[model samples]
Target: MAGDASPAVAALSEAELLSRIFPRLAVDATHSAATLLGPGDDAAIISAPDARTVISIDTQVQDQDFRLAWPNGYRSTGFDVGWKAAAQNLSDINAMGARATSMVVSLTLPPDTPVTWVEDLADGLTAGIRGLGADGCSVAGGDLGRGREISVTVAVLGTLDGGPPVLRSGAQPGDVLALAGTAGQAAAGLALLESGVPMEQLDDGLRNLTERQRRPVPPLQAGPAARKAGATAMLDVSDGLLRDGRRMALASHVAMDLDPDRLGPLAAGVEPAARLLGRNAMEWVLSGGEDHGLLATFPPDIQLPPGFTAIGSIQALGIDEGPRVTIAGRAADTGGWDHFAD
Candidate 1:
């Protein structure tokens, strides 16, 4: 119903559809190194040089995680969905301080979905893998099925490169908390879209913000870099800063004190959009999610790797404070993206 109704998936058999899409995916340079055996086989073979694999999976469903038509929705392209599907799982691997080496995607579509859309989605998947400078990673294989709505599930495989996986529970008191990539911009973009502002009238900055919300590009390299730099604890910021920070704090049995002053620079990028909407930029910075930036902690003496900014410090949990996160010396709310939150 969304695209041109002609040349739909129903026009061809499953084998016919695979013939059209598989070649586009198999030709990507990124897949060649990781995939020993690709499509047309019973299963794909991927290399795991580190003797251990870090795996993560994520799913995106139509109208829930995305929408084809809505002022507040992404009105997403196939590439956008493909890129985002890969990105979310890649970020998870990165959070563990590993390099993503391969992925398997599962897609479900309505009978009337366009074949071109599926091909474009494959292109987006390859683009996302190579986009992270992960030239060796590939889409191993996937399953396709008819469903009520379009849905994508991506599972990624990563390698630690002989390094220990960084766990959220390893942070210690005096560890310097750092962040890589962005915060708030994606949320601001969502707000702008919901505001019903005409996309054509938006400035370049606002356009970029909305694009981020639709398809976030997390710093995939930063994860392994943080691990190599001796990060004690880490995670990707899929949820809001406050929410994810609290998760790490609780896991580590510590408390975090985030300085508002230090977060100002990070919040600056969203200020224009925030002002235009008459909203507080800082709130977005604090509570906005889906940026997929890496949040990590390191020994106070360790120099942070490139792309990371020191934002806070870890502390011993006070008896009353419990395992919590604080901003500007006050306990912060753990409000963020909750799938079933009322």
Candidate 2:
């Protein structure tokens, strides 16, 4: 605590820290219409207009999920963690074809943590909720505690707006597989953050990659749009494409064959990083995750929803075999983020 920015959060009483955090999390009552009551209460009351609420939760841990300082000399900021917390949780609700309405975030800080960093995290959470186009969502309430490492957990609630929630098991053979956001850029960005290259030496495009790693932009609008367009099944590409695609295939009881030509643009986005890092861009696109893009399947007759482009098609499962994701009629490698594997 001597050299640290501020004596870890331990020095400040929980009430004292709450006093500092509340102001940063205040929301406009006009915009946060769905939240009947927010923070300062035992639990928040949210208005679920559709009478059904969709819920999801996700967690990020220090070092395991993110690093304070990277090999490239870049330091992870509180804002980065806060934004990512919002992104990943919101992405879960999005995958269900629902619009997020409220979120409760829990934070665990180490003894040496800086007060300024916590404030920045609060600011980042507010910014992510607004900047990421979740206009209807608001921070309801959360918990804080002392822990060995920084940890963040977010539980979010969403509304289907009276529509049926899209499920992964709804996909059928002959459905058109589509994607609604950039792929591989974030994995490329992660590579840049962990690279030995000096930050100053990176060009704007290269730096952009790192930005994605720090703050991913999940396509919030695409979810409802796909649902409106009758998307049969969907999920967020949080894990690598192959990994998540394999999941969708299994859930839908179908096989998926991605068109390499359709994936070219996604791969191209990471070429600069791939070349610099001596890695394969296509691999990044195929196996990379964390962009929070939507992966959905739509019926063959209708036009894909806005912000979506067809990348593949659903097919019947192979003879006596399970569902799998393939490229050019061959099973693709399922390599992506695996917490247990790591």
Candidate 3:
């Protein structure tokens, strides 16, 4: 492989690269308590205190999901990619109402990719895991490979801590719909990035929005809290609220009725950007994707978990009306992120 030294990764043997990068992952001292055994073995051992494991995987590819270059595209840093990658998978585990325990990441990179970039990526991943306040979660192990483009795949493992896993099919009529974190920020940031607005020209708020697009911070704690509070159904809003809400409604055989008044606060954060782009902030709030916030339904009489705000309600699906989601008494646009759609 060293003979094909045209790319940086090829300049050194795989062993050499691993030797240089593992230390940067920081899996040593601040490791998760749930990690019984971490990297350097054939396989890792993680604790499943609940005797059941929750797992989820996600992948990010170069150009398709992000770009390392400028204002014309996603000026994402290695840290941003690592952070977003971890957040995406962690959100999935959270949606199941489990606590993240460990992760195994696989990386496919071009030979020319720098070693420092990989190191920074590891740091970002560590930061993301720790940021969740799950001191028991860690990156157990991973694999590295050579490819034409950069791609990151992470498989996360979590434990329900003896609680039943939350599912989208559990909502029932009269359940209150709630949300635990901000929405529209990621989509608004994406719009700003695609608008050709130079980073230097951006104010602090716009800059923050761009950062959100680069590295989203999902409310990881809300998932388990909602479950503990007896949530009937739940999911992570990786897609737009309307789209995902429709999914939950269909699964639960119910109708989701969103109150625009309840969504106003969520839309306010993006109003400035929406005005600058001549787009509606509410549209972003309802249809934007990648926020990864927890969306849940609970019995109306149950007190909502901390950080969760009531935003909608679940109703029985009428005989004439199939399972659907609505906002302000009207059907909402189902448009959202579709990898295969033109």
Candidate 4:
């Protein structure tokens, strides 16, 4: 309790921690093999005889990565943290064109953390996992230790399900760039909250804006669908689209032009949130992060996969530089989220 910032962070008990945090970290049981051994005894084992296993992990630490006191209650913050961890990890499996079969989480926190906050964290992770229909992934196992701040790490195991994995380098110049899900809502929400605007003052239109900061619902189905539809290249919109799109452009060696008109429709009804904070909704849509949407490029004339809209087009290589982002034929200056740079 030496450096604990909140009273809630200092009141967590062992049983309380077990109930709240443990469930969220358990892996799914239904899809696992009968030969898999876990809990109760010495060590855990699994039989993956049929399909290829793909694994990915992600970790989060307080202050350096998240704030327990920002925007909302500690419970909401825990939920957001858990949801983000699950989304990022699950996206890695989806990127491989695989089905996530299981997940395990390890958490470290200050001993004084409240039991309720831990439970909320687990609930958030569960909500996110359910959204993906990742039935097999459960909170399988983890270890906890005393720490100065909360730290969470999740490892996800997936089955390729007999398909080829999509990669960032697969895009070509003739492909059409498409996206599913809104961009920048989280950033706008952060702005609103930061500017001292109360959530009650805003209408329902902006709820999604704030929610984006808490729980990012990734388009899990889109990756496999695009692969099935013969997408030439693909990526998840974890970072801002412009930044990630620039990544795609550089990786594939092409220029990208985005139609703001097309993007405008994708971000409909968020102006009130913008107005509340004296910010531009369009700027949020263009530059926000953590939406966890899907971004992909496909053949120009082919029918697009379901649930996606045409947002832009892949361009031929330019003589000027790497990954130019243009809006309505004019160059856009913003392209990324630089954590350390202003």
By TM-score, the best candidate is 2
Q: What value does the lDDT take at residue 143 in candidate 1?
A: 88
Q: Evaluate all candidate structures by whole-model CA lDDT and list the values in order.
A: 0.86, 0.91, 0.87, 0.72
Compute the lDDT of residue 87 as modeled in candidate 4: 84
After superposing candidate 4, which stretches have Cα over 4 Å from the reference? 1-35, 39-51, 71-77, 318-321
**Per-residue lDDT of candidate 1, residues 1-342 (tens digit):** 655855999899999998877776774564467677777677877888877878899999998887776584335788888888878888899899998888888899999998888988898888877776665788878888999999999989888989999999999999999999999988998888777777877899999998888778888888899999999999989889999999999999999989898899978999999988999898888889989999999999999998899999999976776898998778788888888985
For candidate 2, the TM-score is 0.98
- Tens digit of per-residue lDDT, candidate 4, span 178-214: 9876687777766655555566765676666777766
TM-score leaderboard ranking: 2, 1, 3, 4
TM-score of each: 0.96, 0.98, 0.95, 0.86
Clashing pairs in 3: none
Which predicted model would earn the best lDDT?
2
Q: lDDT of model 2 at residue 210?
A: 95
Q: Kindly report which residue stretches of model 1 are placed more than 4 angstroms away from their true locations once superposed.
A: 2-6, 27-31, 72-74
Per-residue lDDT tens digits for candidate 3, residues 161-217, read: 999999999999999999988889999988888887787787899889888887888
> For each candidate, how many residue pairs have backbone atoms clashing (under 3 Å)?
0, 0, 0, 17
